[model samples]
Target: MGQHESNTKLIWQVFGFLSIVTIVEVILGIIKPHGLHFTNFLGTSLLNWIFIILTLVKAAGIMWYFMHMNHERKNFVNSIILPLIILIPYLVTLLLIEGHYIHEVMGSYINWKY
Candidate 1:
């Protein structure tokens, strides 16, 4: 009972932090500054880079604190995270390639003529 209550309080703290991060992300999205409009590594825009880093930070914090991954055993933690690590890059690559294909198709083949 005591331990449960302690964990409940910790969960609330994590939720609060998550909420704050989400709010900041929304604000940044709404108030996008010109300074962050430049392209950086791999041609990813600076604004997109900011969003990606912040999103990853929020994800890691949630998984570590809210999901209690930090308290799990070594094998348990690796089993979940290692698969995600392997899959995310592949997913991103597929998305990027498909996006570029869509862009080229729309730009070249989809001529608006009536």
Candidate 2:
């Protein structure tokens, strides 16, 4: 009974943390501060950067707790997470490069009105 109660408490705590982070993400998305929304960093707006970072944090938390990665060996955890850590940046870089190329190519021909 005690163990069950403790597990329930832990579940609630994790739920609360995840909920708070999600709420913050949603609020920021809706109310995008002008300062953050306008500033560019690494070819993306600061607000976008914040969203990416918060999403990563939530993913890490879910993996560590809900997926029980925290109990695994360090090497095992690294093996599972390292690829994701590497893949995201690589994919983002690819996306940025492709988008820039497309923009440049289209700009030459389109004469965008806006």
Cα lDDT listed for each candidate:
0.77, 0.86
- Residue 68 accuracy (lDDT) in model 2: 86
Worst 10 residues of 1 by lDDT: 36-45
Q: Count the backbone clashes (under 3 Å) in each candidate.
A: 0, 0
Residue range 20-52, candidate 2, lDDT tens digits: 999999999888899998898998778888888
Give stretches of model 1 more than 4 Å off.
1-5, 108-114
Report clash pairs, candidate 2. none
- By summed lDDT, the worst window of 10 consecutive residues in model 2 runs over 1-10
User: Would you estimate the TM-scores of all the predictions?
Assistant: 0.73, 0.80
